[model samples]
Target: MIYSFKILQRYQLSKVILVVLLLIVLVVGAVPGYITGKWSWKNTPRITNFKDLRQIREEGLTISDLPTISHQKIRIADHNWLLQKVKQDNQSVILLLLTPNGPKDKPQVEWMDINGFNRWKTDSHQRVKFTVKIAGNGNGTTDSEKQSSNIEARFFRGWTNQQTYAVMQWYAWPGGGSPETGDWFWKDRSAMISKKRVPWVAVNILLPVEPLADIDPYLPQVKSIGEKIQASLMKEAFK
Candidate 1:
């Protein structure tokens, strides 16, 4: 009887230890998520409307006046993005939003190949050629610099009819779980693995500044406004 009692005591002790270890493992695993998740929406910006965008920088163009929107259908391959051409006076901006449901069958998750403007994409159109870089498309830019907005507000400088146009684009995403800027590949790849629906917006703009030998002068305005818009929309999105 004593031998049987000893065996039972040992069995109970082992079972208790296993349960304690399991609890410790669960808490250990969940701690990081719990601590970091608290600030998920911390740095994200709020969502803004067209009016808010124009207000960011008016430049005496009277852009506040209701602008005209052209509902044009633009495609980036099997993915069909919602396209809008907003024109105010002599200034214009194109907005593209990638949605799961569009003219084409919905992709498991939507992705925008903003690489269409890269000069290598076409053989013709020699005179109006445009080159674009989005940081993580295997371009030499370091991951630290490509972390945000740089990929979104990609630079473009090209001439047509002896006039140069300076342009850029930015991708907008909500706060929580929003991929850091320029982390295009990692975010999408992770989404594909986890089967998470990726949501984002792209803003393309033709700056109102006069183009010169180089378009670097207009870059700051585009970047500042782009960041403002992102902050406005992202905070709202997460809210």
Candidate 2:
């Protein structure tokens, strides 16, 4: 009777091992599919529908008449990335930020409600701007002296119906001649375009804001911004 019991126990142990092996194989096979699905989804331009609208509301963008939201994801490296053309007032705003691992994996909010953004501010007269002096690494954790430098410089938010057009001129011509900045706009863009554009270095100088630790801590906020911008775009597109 004892011998019979030992045989039964050995058989059950083998069955358990076999089950474990199968689970491992299943997980391994599923991994590729999971990665592919994510890649495909990220590559696709955002599509808004009723379901997506509901999600936008949950993120804190008040949708009284529904807002239009459109986004295209740009993956810079295996890790870092950015999202473009996220707007809330159906206005075009280019949000540039770090997309590190963990919570920072999502795009950091750089600019919102952007009436227009320029590589270089033109003419002290036309530009409505603000500058903050930043010295240390922009991580807000630094002493008040360092953190106080977080600055948002802009010329104008709404001067006419052509906000993005003026901004795009800066983006495209970059260093193109401008009567305001005394043609410094073209000089700056020319220099930036000439150099083998350094990753993140160029933008860091333009914004000069510090990193906010890991992204996870700020993901909810990021999602909320994305959704609102998306909803605003959707409302316009649907109209």
Candidate 3:
């Protein structure tokens, strides 16, 4: 990055020395970045594994525990509270569900915030306690723009009064890729709007927020569900 001609003018260094010095600078600058990327990629948790959660039914869980899909046209006045990631669209689709919090596992919710704004006033309906939100990726890529990257999504646990819901969601790309933090390969894919990959489907998985166990530990199960949903959507979309 540093272009220098005058530095060589004063040193009178031989061409061989200049070449070696330049190589050293380039190698020194490049190694750290390469190592960092490798480390990040290796450490990123693969939170989704559908195979492990086959017992979800045996654990007193059923599809009926989940909410069905619903879509609504966005009213002009309700723009302020659009789910941060899915906001650019004229309509929003929500998949909501709820489960019992037995005495052993009470729900601990960290409500939701969107575009630096809390979503209390604009909350219109309460079908399920949790509201899945597809949040924006800080770079300002909205639901309005087209994207080419894989997926970027997360969960927001929250409650309305005593009822709580675990809101899981992510951006679904036609070409699949994981957007979680240690997946540094996607750092480039999501960085630019021109290369950004966006799909309309947001994979949502709602579960009870159990106090005895953190939802994070079950992320692999959570991820599995999202992946299945994402795969089905991708197949239908690309077809």
Query: Quick one: best TM-score, which candidate?
Result: 1
lDDT of all predictions: 0.43, 0.31, 0.36
Model 3 agreement with the true structure over 121-162: per-residue lDDT tens digits: 222122211112232335565764323334555655544444
Stronger candidate by lDDT (1 vs 3) = 1
Candidate 1 similarity to native, TM-score = 0.40
What tens digits encode model 2's per-residue C-alpha lDDT throughout 85-181? 4444454444432322331122223333121333333222232122222333445644553312111222221233222112211111111111133
Superposed Cα deviation of residue 204, candidate 1 (Å): 3.0
Listing every candidate in turn, what is its Cα RMSD in Å to the true structure after a full C-alpha superposition?
17.0, 22.9, 19.3
- For candidate 2, what is the lDDT? 0.31
lDDT of 3: 0.36
TM-score of every model versus the real structure: 0.40, 0.21, 0.33
Off by over 4 Å in 2: 1-68, 76-79, 100-149, 152-239
